[model samples]
Target: MPNAELPQAKRQKMANKTIGTHNGTFHCDEALATFVLKQTDEYSDADVVRSRDPAVLDTCDIVVDVGAVYDAEKKRFDHHQRGFTDVHYGLEIIAKRLGTALDDPKVQYVWLKLYRDFIEAIDAIDNGISQYDSDVPARYRSRTDLSSRVATLNPRWNEPTGAQILDARFQDASALTGKEFFQALDYYRDSWLPAADLVKDLITSSKQSADPSGRILVFEQFAPWKEHLFEIEADENVPSVEPNQAIYVLYPDEAGGNWRVQAVPVSPSSFESRKSLPEAWRGIRDDELSKLTGIDGCIFVHASGFIGGNKTKEGALSMAKKALEL
Candidate 1:
C-alpha cells in the first residue's frame, strides 16, 4: 500500500498559496487557469478566492483572467487588457524566470503543443476570436462546450447572484475545467512524450533495415506515427537521422487480424501522401485485388490509394514492396 502521509507535505505547502479570480459569473479561461495552477507544485493546494474586490485580489498570491494587469513577476495573468495577446505572453515570462530556455524543445513542446490540444480554444473564446473566418460557410452551429457549460452554471435569471450562490457556481465551474486540464496534461506527459522516443527508434531502425533508398518503414506494432514521423523527418539537428525519405509504412491491423500498408503523408495535416498505392489497385478488393496485384490475401485499397490491407504480414510487405517499385 502507498504511504498515507505522502500528500501531507504537499498539502501543507499548497495551503499557503491563494488564487484569486473574479466573482459572480465565470468563464472557461479563468476556470481552466485555476485548474492549471493547482496542478503545479507552487499552487497545488492553494486557496481559491472568487471575488472582484481589488482588496481581496490584492491579498492573493496569484490572480488570473480577472486582473487587468499582465505582470508575470507579480503573477497576474489576464488577457483582457489592451495590447494583450495570447496566454503565451505570460507563460513565456514565467518560463524565462524559471531558467527554462525559449529554444528548448520541452519548453516549446509545453507551450506550443498545449496551445493546440488545450489552450487555444480557451484563448479564442476569451478573446472573442472566431476559429473560422466570417466568410466560411457553416452548415450547422453548436454551443455545447466548456464555455457554454460554465455559463449554464451561473444563477438562473430569476435567482439572486449572492455571494453564496456565486461561490457555489464557481466551484462547479472550476471542477469542470480542472477535470479537462489534468486529463490533457496527463495525456501529454504520459502518452505523447513517451511515443516520440518509440517513433524515433522506429524511424532509425527502419532506415537501417530498408533498401538503399531508405523509403519504406516496417512497424512491428501499430502506433500513432503521423505527427512523430513529420517531426523526425523535419528535425535537422539530429546527427544520424536523414530528412524525409520514408514513403510508406507497414503494420498489422489490430481488429481484423490482418496487415496494413499505409502511404506516408507529406505532412501530418496533409491529406496528400508521398507515394500512394498503385493507381490500378484503388477501390479494388478481395480476389480481384489479389489477381491484379499478384499478391495473395489482398483485402482492399482505399479509393484515394492512401491505404490497403492484406490477410497476412507477408502479403502486406509484398504489397508495400511492389508499391515502392511503382
Candidate 2:
C-alpha cells in the first residue's frame, strides 16, 4: 500500500506543508489551554501558537478573536454585557471557534501542526531561565510631578512581577533589572492552558499501524465523550456518530484532574485545510461534527486495554483498543 496508509503527521501534505508557526508567549488561563488540547490536532495548535503570539489570531480560520466576554473588576464572565473586556472569556470564544472548524478534516490536521509549535514553545518557556523572583511587583503604578495646575495623568509603567516589590527600595528594581515576574500568571498561561506536542504525536503515531479488523483504533490521549459517566447529567441522549468521524478520548493526567478534550483552530498556515479529520479519526470532517460530539471527552477503555510503550505507534494503538473496552 502507498504511504497513504501512514499517519497524518507522516502524510505527504504534512511533509509538503511548511508553515512557520509563532511561539507561545502571552498571558492566558488554564481554561483556554485545556479547551485547546482536547480538540483536533490542527485546530488545537493554531490557537496555542497564537497564545504565544496573538497577532496570528486574525489570520487563523478555526479560531478568531470575537472579543471579550467578561469583566475582571466586575468579577464575572459576562458583567451584563455591560463590560469592557474579559481577557479570560475572550480567549474562550476563540477556542470555541476552533472546535467548530472540525467540520473539515483538512482544516483540523493543518491546525494540528500549528498546535505542535505552541506545545513546544510552552515547554521551552516553562523550563526556561525565567524565574519567580519574589523581589519585584509584576507591574507598578506611579505619578511624577511633571506639570502644575491640572495635574497630568502619570503614565503607568508595566513589568514582570516578583517578591522584590516588598523590600529593597534602594535597588529600584525598575532601574536595576528593568523587569519583574508573575508566577501565577505564567503558570496559568503557558504550562497549564496551551496545547502540547505530546498529544499530537499520539494522534499521528497511532494512525500508521495495521488494523485488519478495523474494529480497533489507537489514540495517544483522546477523551471519550460518549461513555461519560456525568454525560447523562449534562445531556442524556447519546448521539449517533458518523463512521468516518474520528473518536475523541480522554486519559488520566496529573494536570487535568477532570474529564476534558482539546481541539485545533484555523490559522493562516492551516487555513487551506478544512476537509476531513484523519482515518484513525474516521477521515471525515466538515459537516461530520454534529455526529461526533459523543466522542468529545470519554475514557471508554478499561484498565486492561492499556499497554505501556506509548512512544511507539503500535503500542499506542494497543492502549487505544484497551481504552475502548473501558
Candidate 3:
C-alpha cells in the first residue's frame, strides 16, 4: 500500500517544533510554548508572553529554521535546511536514545521524527522493495498490516547486525543504488549512532604501557537532566533509563603511560550543549569523543553517540564494549 497522507495537525506539530512558528512568543501550552520559546534566542523563558503565530517567528534566527534563513536585511533566503533529514533525525536520535533509558523518571518524555523528504523517498522505491521482499527469503519476514505471507523485516532485531540484515532483506545494496533505498538506510543508521571506536578508545586506554606520555587522560563532560528528555522503556523483562550523551576520561597511573580505564562514572552534572544540532550533549563528552563513543552497563548500554535514539546505560556502555571485538 502507498504511504498514507499525514494529517495537518501532525504536519503543524512538526513545523512548530522544527520550523518554528511563523510568529510566536506564546505557544499552545506549557510544553509546546516552552518548546517553541526555547527554540527562539531572546524568548528563552517559557512564561514570557508575546505573539503566537508562525509568521511572528521571523525574529527566530537560523537555528530553528527548517529551510533557508530569511535574511530580513537581504530580503532573500540564504542557506536552506539542507536535506532537512540531518536535523530531523539528529534530534530524533538523541530523543530516542534517551527513551531507551526511561526508568530514571527524571526524563518526562522522549520522541523522534523524520522529515517529509524521508517519506517521499520511501514512496519512490515501494515497487523495488516489494519485489525484493517477494523474491528473497530469510529466517523471517515481517507482516504488513497482518497480511498473509508478509515477511517481517524487523523480527527480533539484532544490534549492529540490523543494518546488514536490512541490506540483505531486499536486493544487493551495491546493485540497487536507488535514492529511496539509500534514504531508508540513512534513516536506519541515524536511528542509532555507531559504537565502533568508543570500544577501541576505552580498551586501548585501559592498557598500561608504562609510558607516561602514552597514558590516557580521562576527561568527562556532563549535563543536567532538565534540558534533556530521557525515556525509560517498560519491559516486563527489564526496565531502565539510558543516558543521552556521555564522556569518559581514561587516565592511567602515569603520564604518557597507557592509562587503563581506572574508573568509569557518569558525570553528575549533565549540562546543556551549545552546538549546531538540536540535541544537547555533555560538553566534555561531545568535544573529545568521536563517532565511535558508546558505553555498556550491567542493565543497559549508556552510549554517547547515536544508537537508534539512545542505548540503555547497560546496552550503551557494556554491550558496545562487547561489539568492539567484532
Best by lDDT: 1
In order of listing, the candidates' clash counts read 0, 67, 77
What does each candidate score in C-alpha RMSD? 6.2, 23.1, 22.2
Model 2 Cα lDDT, one tens digit per residue, 145-185: 11110111111246443323212221232122111112322
For candidate 1, the 10 contiguous residues with the lowest summed lDDT are 88-97
Give lDDT for model 3.
0.29
TM-score of candidate 3 to 2 decimals = 0.18
Alpha carbon lDDT at 97, candidate 3: 35
- Candidate numbers sorted by lDDT from highest down: 1, 2, 3
Query: Is candidate 1 or 3 superior in TM-score?
Result: 1
Best by TM-score: 1
Model 1 lDDT tens row, 34-76: 8778766677778889888888999999999886898777888
lDDT of 3 by residue, 50-121 (tens): 223435544443223222454434222222323323322224332333444434321222223233333332
Better of 1 and 2 by TM-score: 1
- Candidate 1: stretches off by over 4 Å: 1-15, 83-108
User: Candidates ranked by TM-score, best first?
Assistant: 1, 2, 3
- Report how far off residue 20 is in candidate 3 (Å): 4.0
Cα deviation in Å at residue 235, candidate 2? 23
- lDDT-wise, the better of 2 and 3 is 2
Error of 3 at 27 (Å): 15
